[model samples]
Target: MRWKHIVAASLVLASLSGCSWVNKLVYRIDINQGNYIDQTAVEELKFGMTKEQVKFLLGPPMLVESGYPNTWYFVQYLKPGHDAPEQKELILSFDNSGQLVGMKGDYQPGSGFFEAVR
Candidate 1:
Protein backbone atom coordinates (compact mmCIF):
# COMPACT_ATOMS: atom_id res chain seq x y z
CA MET A 1 0.00 0.00 0.00
CA ARG A 2 2.91 2.41 0.79
CA TRP A 3 4.57 1.58 -2.54
CA LYS A 4 1.32 2.39 -4.34
CA HIS A 5 1.20 5.75 -2.55
CA ILE A 6 4.83 6.40 -3.53
CA VAL A 7 4.06 5.59 -7.18
CA ALA A 8 1.03 7.90 -7.15
CA ALA A 9 3.04 10.75 -5.63
CA SER A 10 5.76 10.24 -8.24
CA LEU A 11 3.23 10.65 -11.07
CA VAL A 12 1.91 13.86 -9.52
CA LEU A 13 5.44 15.23 -9.11
CA ALA A 14 6.37 14.40 -12.68
CA SER A 15 3.26 16.15 -14.01
CA LEU A 16 4.02 19.28 -12.03
CA SER A 17 7.62 19.34 -13.31
CA GLY A 18 6.36 19.90 -16.85
CA CYS A 19 4.63 23.17 -15.95
CA SER A 20 6.03 26.24 -17.72
CA TRP A 21 6.01 28.38 -14.59
CA VAL A 22 8.16 25.85 -12.78
CA ASN A 23 10.75 26.12 -15.52
CA LYS A 24 10.72 29.85 -15.11
CA LEU A 25 11.64 29.46 -11.49
CA VAL A 26 14.69 27.33 -12.35
CA TYR A 27 15.92 29.30 -15.41
CA ARG A 28 16.22 33.01 -15.94
CA ILE A 29 15.82 34.54 -19.38
CA ASP A 30 18.32 37.04 -20.72
CA ILE A 31 16.98 40.38 -21.94
CA ASN A 32 18.64 42.18 -24.82
CA GLN A 33 17.21 45.31 -26.33
CA GLY A 34 18.26 48.10 -28.76
CA ASN A 35 20.91 48.66 -31.42
CA TYR A 36 24.58 47.59 -31.17
CA ILE A 37 27.05 50.24 -32.34
CA ASP A 38 30.53 49.36 -33.48
CA GLN A 39 33.40 51.10 -31.70
CA THR A 40 35.55 50.95 -34.84
CA ALA A 41 32.84 52.69 -36.84
CA VAL A 42 32.60 55.43 -34.23
CA GLU A 43 36.33 55.96 -34.57
CA GLU A 44 35.76 56.71 -38.22
CA LEU A 45 33.74 59.82 -37.43
CA LYS A 46 35.16 63.16 -38.55
CA PHE A 47 34.18 66.64 -37.48
CA GLY A 48 32.75 67.72 -40.83
CA MET A 49 31.06 64.48 -41.89
CA THR A 50 27.50 64.79 -43.15
CA LYS A 51 24.46 63.21 -41.53
CA GLU A 52 24.31 60.73 -44.37
CA GLN A 53 27.87 59.71 -43.63
CA VAL A 54 27.17 59.24 -39.94
CA LYS A 55 24.11 57.20 -40.73
CA PHE A 56 26.12 55.01 -43.04
CA LEU A 57 28.67 54.42 -40.30
CA LEU A 58 26.46 53.89 -37.24
CA GLY A 59 23.07 53.06 -38.68
CA PRO A 60 19.97 55.07 -37.68
CA PRO A 61 19.49 56.51 -34.23
CA MET A 62 17.21 54.65 -31.85
CA LEU A 63 15.55 57.84 -30.64
CA VAL A 64 15.80 61.56 -31.51
CA GLU A 65 13.41 62.95 -28.87
CA SER A 66 15.37 66.16 -28.20
CA GLY A 67 12.94 67.86 -30.65
CA TYR A 68 15.91 68.62 -32.90
CA PRO A 69 16.29 66.63 -36.09
CA ASN A 70 19.96 67.51 -36.31
CA THR A 71 20.58 65.68 -33.01
CA TRP A 72 20.73 61.92 -33.36
CA TYR A 73 20.75 59.43 -30.47
CA PHE A 74 21.95 55.83 -30.51
CA VAL A 75 20.99 53.73 -27.50
CA GLN A 76 21.66 50.15 -26.43
CA TYR A 77 20.12 48.69 -23.27
CA LEU A 78 20.82 45.29 -21.75
CA LYS A 79 19.63 43.82 -18.47
CA PRO A 80 20.99 40.51 -17.29
CA GLY A 81 20.31 38.70 -14.04
CA HIS A 82 19.81 40.67 -10.79
CA ASP A 83 22.73 43.01 -11.46
CA ALA A 84 22.50 46.62 -12.69
CA PRO A 85 21.25 47.01 -16.23
CA GLU A 86 23.76 48.10 -18.86
CA GLN A 87 22.95 51.33 -20.66
CA LYS A 88 24.78 53.01 -23.56
CA GLU A 89 23.70 56.22 -25.25
CA LEU A 90 25.53 57.84 -28.15
CA ILE A 91 24.69 61.39 -29.17
CA LEU A 92 25.58 62.90 -32.50
CA SER A 93 25.09 66.57 -33.13
CA PHE A 94 24.84 67.94 -36.64
CA ASP A 95 25.29 71.51 -37.72
CA ASN A 96 22.54 73.51 -39.40
CA SER A 97 24.01 72.57 -42.76
CA GLY A 98 23.61 68.83 -41.91
CA GLN A 99 27.26 68.20 -41.16
CA LEU A 100 28.14 66.20 -38.06
CA VAL A 101 29.90 68.39 -35.52
CA GLY A 102 30.18 66.46 -32.24
CA MET A 103 29.64 63.13 -30.54
CA LYS A 104 29.15 61.99 -26.92
CA GLY A 105 28.57 58.48 -25.69
CA ASP A 106 29.52 55.60 -23.39
CA TYR A 107 32.57 54.79 -25.49
CA GLN A 108 35.92 56.25 -24.45
CA PRO A 109 37.09 56.66 -28.10
CA GLY A 110 40.64 56.02 -26.79
CA SER A 111 43.55 58.47 -27.15
CA GLY A 112 43.75 58.02 -30.89
CA PHE A 113 40.09 57.53 -31.68
CA PHE A 114 40.28 59.96 -34.55
CA GLU A 115 43.84 59.04 -35.42
CA ALA A 116 45.45 55.72 -36.34
CA VAL A 117 45.93 53.37 -33.38
CA ARG A 118 49.31 51.62 -33.03
Candidate 2:
Protein backbone atom coordinates (compact mmCIF):
# COMPACT_ATOMS: atom_id res chain seq x y z
CA MET A 1 0.00 0.00 0.00
CA ARG A 2 2.87 2.39 0.85
CA TRP A 3 4.57 1.47 -2.46
CA LYS A 4 1.38 2.25 -4.30
CA HIS A 5 1.20 5.67 -2.69
CA ILE A 6 4.84 6.34 -3.56
CA VAL A 7 4.26 5.40 -7.19
CA ALA A 8 1.26 7.64 -7.43
CA ALA A 9 3.16 10.53 -5.87
CA SER A 10 6.04 9.99 -8.29
CA LEU A 11 3.68 10.05 -11.23
CA VAL A 12 2.14 13.29 -10.02
CA LEU A 13 5.53 14.87 -9.63
CA ALA A 14 6.56 13.70 -13.08
CA SER A 15 3.45 15.16 -14.64
CA LEU A 16 3.97 18.46 -12.89
CA SER A 17 7.55 18.65 -14.10
CA GLY A 18 6.44 17.92 -17.65
CA CYS A 19 3.84 20.66 -17.41
CA SER A 20 6.40 23.20 -16.30
CA TRP A 21 8.59 22.37 -19.26
CA VAL A 22 5.66 22.65 -21.62
CA ASN A 23 4.67 26.03 -20.17
CA LYS A 24 8.17 27.37 -20.63
CA LEU A 25 8.19 26.25 -24.23
CA VAL A 26 4.81 27.77 -24.95
CA TYR A 27 5.42 31.15 -23.31
CA ARG A 28 8.87 31.72 -24.69
CA ILE A 29 9.16 35.13 -26.36
CA ASP A 30 9.58 34.90 -30.06
CA ILE A 31 12.28 37.48 -30.73
CA ASN A 32 11.25 37.79 -34.37
CA GLN A 33 8.41 40.33 -34.37
CA GLY A 34 10.54 43.39 -33.59
CA ASN A 35 11.52 44.53 -37.03
CA TYR A 36 10.85 48.26 -37.82
CA ILE A 37 12.65 48.78 -41.09
CA ASP A 38 11.53 48.09 -44.63
CA GLN A 39 12.99 47.56 -48.12
CA THR A 40 12.42 51.10 -49.36
CA ALA A 41 14.78 52.38 -46.68
CA VAL A 42 17.26 49.67 -47.54
CA GLU A 43 17.12 50.64 -51.17
CA GLU A 44 17.76 54.26 -50.25
CA LEU A 45 21.16 53.49 -48.74
CA LYS A 46 23.91 54.99 -50.84
CA PHE A 47 27.58 54.04 -50.93
CA GLY A 48 29.01 57.42 -49.93
CA MET A 49 26.87 58.00 -46.83
CA THR A 50 28.56 58.50 -43.44
CA LYS A 51 27.56 56.69 -40.25
CA GLU A 52 25.82 59.72 -38.84
CA GLN A 53 24.09 60.14 -42.14
CA VAL A 54 22.93 56.56 -42.09
CA LYS A 55 21.59 56.99 -38.59
CA PHE A 56 19.76 60.09 -39.66
CA LEU A 57 18.25 58.32 -42.58
CA LEU A 58 17.41 54.92 -41.09
CA GLY A 59 17.64 55.44 -37.33
CA PRO A 60 20.07 53.09 -35.54
CA PRO A 61 20.85 49.62 -36.73
CA MET A 62 19.81 46.66 -34.60
CA LEU A 63 23.46 45.64 -34.35
CA VAL A 64 26.90 46.85 -35.23
CA GLU A 65 29.50 44.26 -36.08
CA SER A 66 32.52 44.49 -33.77
CA GLY A 67 36.10 44.14 -35.04
CA TYR A 68 34.70 45.06 -38.41
CA PRO A 69 34.50 48.85 -38.08
CA ASN A 70 33.15 49.29 -41.53
CA THR A 71 30.30 46.87 -40.95
CA TRP A 72 26.83 48.01 -39.91
CA TYR A 73 23.87 45.74 -39.42
CA PHE A 74 20.15 46.45 -39.57
CA VAL A 75 17.82 43.64 -38.54
CA GLN A 76 14.09 43.17 -37.90
CA TYR A 77 12.41 40.12 -36.38
CA LEU A 78 8.91 38.84 -35.63
CA LYS A 79 8.15 36.11 -33.12
CA PRO A 80 5.65 33.27 -33.56
CA GLY A 81 3.26 34.08 -30.71
CA HIS A 82 2.64 37.49 -32.12
CA ASP A 83 0.87 38.52 -35.34
CA ALA A 84 3.97 37.63 -37.37
CA PRO A 85 6.88 35.23 -37.50
CA GLU A 86 10.19 36.29 -35.98
CA GLN A 87 13.11 37.50 -38.06
CA LYS A 88 16.82 36.77 -37.54
CA GLU A 89 19.45 38.51 -39.62
CA LEU A 90 22.87 40.06 -40.19
CA ILE A 91 24.15 42.96 -42.36
CA LEU A 92 27.77 43.07 -43.39
CA SER A 93 30.41 45.68 -44.22
CA PHE A 94 29.87 49.39 -43.59
CA ASP A 95 33.08 51.36 -43.47
CA ASN A 96 34.08 54.86 -42.28
CA SER A 97 35.55 55.48 -45.67
CA GLY A 98 32.06 56.70 -46.64
CA GLN A 99 31.60 53.51 -48.60
CA LEU A 100 28.92 50.88 -48.17
CA VAL A 101 30.09 47.41 -49.01
CA GLY A 102 28.40 44.06 -49.06
CA MET A 103 25.06 45.17 -47.64
CA LYS A 104 22.72 42.21 -47.28
CA GLY A 105 19.26 41.21 -46.08
CA ASP A 106 17.86 37.96 -44.69
CA TYR A 107 14.38 36.79 -43.73
CA GLN A 108 12.97 33.44 -42.71
CA PRO A 109 9.78 31.48 -43.67
CA GLY A 110 9.08 34.17 -46.27
CA SER A 111 10.97 36.66 -48.39
CA GLY A 112 9.73 40.27 -48.52
CA PHE A 113 9.92 43.54 -46.60
CA PHE A 114 8.08 44.03 -43.33
CA GLU A 115 6.05 47.21 -43.52
CA ALA A 116 7.29 49.87 -41.12
CA VAL A 117 5.25 49.89 -37.93
CA ARG A 118 4.53 53.62 -38.22
Candidate 3:
Protein backbone atom coordinates (compact mmCIF):
# COMPACT_ATOMS: atom_id res chain seq x y z
CA MET A 1 0.00 0.00 0.00
CA ARG A 2 2.83 2.41 0.85
CA TRP A 3 4.52 1.59 -2.47
CA LYS A 4 1.28 2.42 -4.29
CA HIS A 5 1.15 5.83 -2.61
CA ILE A 6 4.77 6.52 -3.51
CA VAL A 7 4.14 5.60 -7.11
CA ALA A 8 1.13 7.94 -7.28
CA ALA A 9 3.11 10.75 -5.72
CA SER A 10 5.94 10.18 -8.18
CA LEU A 11 3.49 10.27 -11.06
CA VAL A 12 2.06 13.53 -9.81
CA LEU A 13 5.53 15.05 -9.55
CA ALA A 14 6.37 13.85 -13.00
CA SER A 15 3.18 15.34 -14.43
CA LEU A 16 3.85 18.65 -12.76
CA SER A 17 7.40 18.74 -14.07
CA GLY A 18 6.13 18.05 -17.58
CA CYS A 19 3.60 20.83 -17.24
CA SER A 20 6.30 23.26 -16.14
CA TRP A 21 8.37 22.45 -19.19
CA VAL A 22 5.37 22.91 -21.44
CA ASN A 23 4.52 26.17 -19.71
CA LYS A 24 8.00 27.50 -20.31
CA LEU A 25 7.70 26.66 -23.98
CA VAL A 26 4.18 28.10 -24.28
CA TYR A 27 5.03 31.29 -22.43
CA ARG A 28 7.84 32.28 -24.77
CA ILE A 29 8.01 35.97 -25.62
CA ASP A 30 6.53 37.25 -28.84
CA ILE A 31 7.35 40.64 -30.28
CA ASN A 32 4.40 41.87 -32.28
CA GLN A 33 5.21 45.57 -32.71
CA GLY A 34 8.08 47.53 -34.16
CA ASN A 35 8.87 49.30 -37.39
CA TYR A 36 8.86 46.86 -40.28
CA ILE A 37 10.39 48.91 -43.08
CA ASP A 38 11.35 47.68 -46.52
CA GLN A 39 15.09 47.69 -47.09
CA THR A 40 14.96 47.15 -50.86
CA ALA A 41 13.19 50.46 -51.42
CA VAL A 42 15.87 52.11 -49.37
CA GLU A 43 18.56 50.38 -51.45
CA GLU A 44 16.94 51.48 -54.68
CA LEU A 45 17.42 55.10 -53.67
CA LYS A 46 20.05 56.59 -55.93
CA PHE A 47 22.88 58.88 -54.92
CA GLY A 48 21.22 61.91 -56.51
CA MET A 49 17.87 61.57 -54.76
CA THR A 50 16.77 64.69 -52.93
CA LYS A 51 15.82 64.55 -49.25
CA GLU A 52 12.21 64.97 -50.25
CA GLN A 53 12.51 62.05 -52.62
CA VAL A 54 14.04 59.89 -49.90
CA LYS A 55 11.24 60.82 -47.56
CA PHE A 56 8.64 59.90 -50.15
CA LEU A 57 10.32 56.62 -50.90
CA LEU A 58 11.31 55.20 -47.48
CA GLY A 59 9.29 57.36 -45.12
CA PRO A 60 11.09 58.91 -42.13
CA PRO A 61 14.19 57.04 -41.03
CA MET A 62 14.19 55.40 -37.59
CA LEU A 63 17.13 57.49 -36.57
CA VAL A 64 19.30 59.90 -38.54
CA GLU A 65 23.00 60.05 -38.06
CA SER A 66 23.71 62.63 -35.35
CA GLY A 67 24.88 66.12 -36.38
CA TYR A 68 25.10 64.96 -39.94
CA PRO A 69 22.42 66.71 -41.94
CA ASN A 70 23.67 65.12 -45.11
CA THR A 71 23.61 61.60 -43.69
CA TRP A 72 20.52 59.51 -43.13
CA TYR A 73 20.02 56.13 -41.43
CA PHE A 74 17.04 53.77 -41.58
CA VAL A 75 16.65 51.08 -38.90
CA GLN A 76 14.19 48.35 -37.86
CA TYR A 77 14.05 45.43 -35.40
CA LEU A 78 12.11 42.21 -34.64
CA LYS A 79 12.16 40.38 -31.31
CA PRO A 80 10.23 37.16 -31.69
CA GLY A 81 10.99 35.01 -28.66
CA HIS A 82 12.68 34.95 -25.28
CA ASP A 83 15.06 32.06 -25.96
CA ALA A 84 15.48 33.19 -29.51
CA PRO A 85 17.86 36.08 -29.93
CA GLU A 86 15.98 39.20 -30.96
CA GLN A 87 16.14 39.69 -34.70
CA LYS A 88 17.03 43.35 -34.85
CA GLU A 89 18.19 46.12 -37.13
CA LEU A 90 18.37 47.30 -40.69
CA ILE A 91 20.55 50.32 -41.48
CA LEU A 92 20.89 52.38 -44.64
CA SER A 93 23.16 55.35 -44.94
CA PHE A 94 23.24 58.14 -47.50
CA ASP A 95 26.13 60.45 -48.04
CA ASN A 96 26.16 64.26 -48.12
CA SER A 97 25.97 64.06 -51.88
CA GLY A 98 22.43 62.75 -51.45
CA GLN A 99 23.53 59.37 -52.75
CA LEU A 100 23.50 55.96 -51.10
CA VAL A 101 26.96 55.37 -49.63
CA GLY A 102 26.85 52.42 -47.18
CA MET A 103 24.24 49.90 -46.08
CA LYS A 104 24.47 47.45 -43.20
CA GLY A 105 22.20 45.30 -41.02
CA ASP A 106 19.84 42.66 -42.34
CA TYR A 107 19.09 43.67 -45.94
CA GLN A 108 16.25 41.44 -47.03
CA PRO A 109 15.39 43.05 -50.36
CA GLY A 110 11.89 41.66 -50.81
CA SER A 111 11.11 41.55 -47.09
CA GLY A 112 12.25 45.14 -46.39
CA PHE A 113 11.45 48.74 -47.34
CA PHE A 114 11.99 48.43 -51.10
CA GLU A 115 8.89 46.31 -51.82
CA ALA A 116 6.71 49.33 -52.56
CA VAL A 117 8.88 50.75 -55.33
CA ARG A 118 7.66 48.25 -57.90
Candidate 4:
Protein backbone atom coordinates (compact mmCIF):
# COMPACT_ATOMS: atom_id res chain seq x y z
CA MET A 1 0.00 0.00 0.00
CA ARG A 2 2.82 2.41 0.90
CA TRP A 3 4.57 1.59 -2.41
CA LYS A 4 1.39 2.41 -4.32
CA HIS A 5 1.15 5.75 -2.53
CA ILE A 6 4.78 6.52 -3.40
CA VAL A 7 4.15 5.70 -7.05
CA ALA A 8 1.08 7.93 -7.11
CA ALA A 9 2.99 10.80 -5.50
CA SER A 10 5.83 10.38 -7.94
CA LEU A 11 3.41 10.38 -10.84
CA VAL A 12 1.77 13.56 -9.56
CA LEU A 13 5.14 15.26 -9.13
CA ALA A 14 6.30 14.18 -12.56
CA SER A 15 3.10 15.39 -14.17
CA LEU A 16 3.48 18.77 -12.50
CA SER A 17 7.16 19.09 -13.38
CA GLY A 18 6.60 17.81 -16.92
CA CYS A 19 4.54 20.84 -17.81
CA SER A 20 7.52 23.18 -17.60
CA TRP A 21 9.70 21.25 -20.04
CA VAL A 22 6.75 20.62 -22.36
CA ASN A 23 6.11 24.34 -22.47
CA LYS A 24 9.76 24.91 -23.45
CA LEU A 25 9.47 22.60 -26.46
CA VAL A 26 6.83 24.84 -28.02
CA TYR A 27 8.08 27.93 -29.82
CA ARG A 28 6.74 31.38 -29.10
CA ILE A 29 7.44 34.38 -31.29
CA ASP A 30 8.29 37.69 -29.75
CA ILE A 31 5.47 40.17 -30.16
CA ASN A 32 6.02 43.89 -30.58
CA GLN A 33 3.21 46.42 -30.73
CA GLY A 34 3.09 50.15 -31.34
CA ASN A 35 5.94 52.59 -31.97
CA TYR A 36 9.39 51.68 -30.71
CA ILE A 37 11.00 54.90 -29.63
CA ASP A 38 14.64 54.79 -28.68
CA GLN A 39 16.47 56.96 -26.19
CA THR A 40 18.15 59.04 -28.90
CA ALA A 41 14.81 59.99 -30.41
CA VAL A 42 13.49 61.03 -27.03
CA GLU A 43 16.61 63.05 -26.51
CA GLU A 44 15.98 64.99 -29.70
CA LEU A 45 12.74 66.48 -28.46
CA LYS A 46 12.74 70.21 -27.89
CA PHE A 47 10.41 72.28 -25.78
CA GLY A 48 8.69 74.39 -28.41
CA MET A 49 8.78 71.91 -31.25
CA THR A 50 5.67 71.81 -33.39
CA LYS A 51 3.42 68.81 -33.80
CA GLU A 52 4.85 68.17 -37.22
CA GLN A 53 8.39 68.31 -35.86
CA VAL A 54 7.60 65.91 -33.05
CA LYS A 55 5.94 63.59 -35.51
CA PHE A 56 9.02 63.64 -37.67
CA LEU A 57 11.12 62.57 -34.72
CA LEU A 58 9.00 60.02 -32.85
CA GLY A 59 6.63 58.99 -35.62
CA PRO A 60 2.86 58.86 -35.11
CA PRO A 61 1.66 58.34 -31.59
CA MET A 62 -0.20 55.18 -30.53
CA LEU A 63 -3.17 57.14 -29.28
CA VAL A 64 -4.45 60.60 -30.07
CA GLU A 65 -8.05 60.72 -28.99
CA SER A 66 -10.36 63.19 -30.67
CA GLY A 67 -11.33 64.68 -27.34
CA TYR A 68 -7.70 65.38 -26.49
CA PRO A 69 -6.11 66.75 -29.61
CA ASN A 70 -3.34 68.45 -27.69
CA THR A 71 -2.29 65.31 -25.93
CA TRP A 72 -0.37 62.56 -27.73
CA TYR A 73 0.27 59.09 -26.38
CA PHE A 74 3.12 56.83 -27.42
CA VAL A 75 2.89 53.25 -26.27
CA GLN A 76 5.11 50.21 -26.80
CA TYR A 77 4.42 46.65 -25.72
CA LEU A 78 6.89 43.82 -26.08
CA LYS A 79 6.33 40.17 -25.28
CA PRO A 80 9.13 37.65 -25.40
CA GLY A 81 8.86 33.90 -25.64
CA HIS A 82 10.28 33.07 -22.20
CA ASP A 83 10.44 36.41 -20.46
CA ALA A 84 8.08 38.85 -18.85
CA PRO A 85 6.20 41.26 -21.09
CA GLU A 86 7.17 44.91 -21.01
CA GLN A 87 5.14 48.04 -21.72
CA LYS A 88 6.24 51.63 -22.08
CA GLU A 89 4.31 54.84 -22.54
CA LEU A 90 5.03 58.48 -23.25
CA ILE A 91 2.50 61.24 -22.91
CA LEU A 92 3.09 64.61 -24.52
CA SER A 93 0.98 67.65 -23.85
CA PHE A 94 0.86 70.51 -26.30
CA ASP A 95 -0.35 74.04 -26.01
CA ASN A 96 -3.35 75.48 -27.88
CA SER A 97 -0.99 76.37 -30.72
CA GLY A 98 0.16 72.78 -31.05
CA GLN A 99 3.57 73.39 -29.52
CA LEU A 100 4.99 70.78 -27.17
CA VAL A 101 4.69 72.03 -23.60
CA GLY A 102 4.77 69.03 -21.32
CA MET A 103 5.92 65.44 -21.30
CA LYS A 104 5.14 62.61 -18.90
CA GLY A 105 4.88 58.86 -18.46
CA ASP A 106 7.64 56.22 -18.48
CA TYR A 107 10.21 58.16 -20.52
CA GLN A 108 12.19 61.07 -19.15
CA PRO A 109 12.79 64.21 -21.18
CA GLY A 110 16.27 64.99 -22.39
CA SER A 111 18.49 67.80 -21.16
CA GLY A 112 17.74 69.90 -24.21
CA PHE A 113 14.01 69.83 -23.50
CA PHE A 114 14.22 73.36 -22.16
CA GLU A 115 15.91 74.64 -25.29
CA ALA A 116 13.85 75.48 -28.35
CA VAL A 117 14.74 74.23 -31.77
CA ARG A 118 16.12 76.87 -34.05
How many residue pairs clash in model 2?
16
Sort the candidates on lDDT, descending order: 4, 1, 3, 2
Q: Of the candidates shown, which would achieve the greatest TM-score relative to the real structure?
A: 4
Model 3's alpha-carbon lDDT is 0.61
Candidate 4 structure quality by residue, lDDT tens digits, 40-105: 899889889999999999999999999999999999999999889999999999999999999988
Q: Write the per-residue lDDT of candidate 1 for residues 1-118, one digit (tens) a residue.
A: 9999999999999897776666557755567778788888877787777888778988888987667988888988888754579889889888789977677879655344455321
Worst 10 residues of 4 by lDDT: 109-118
lDDT of 2: 0.60
Which runs of model 3 end up more than 4 angstroms from their true locations? Answer: 1-12, 15-20, 24-29, 32-34, 81-83, 108-118
Badly placed stretches (over 4 Å) of model 4 are: 1-13
Model 2 lDDT-worst window of ten: 109-118
TM-score of decoy 1: 0.65
In the predicted model 1, the residue pairs found to clash are: none
Top-lDDT candidate index: 4
TM-score of every candidate:
0.65, 0.50, 0.55, 0.84
Report the lDDT tens digits of candidate 2 across residue range 1-118: 9999999999999987777566556655555443477656665655555677667756777766577667767667666553456565647455557555455657221122222121
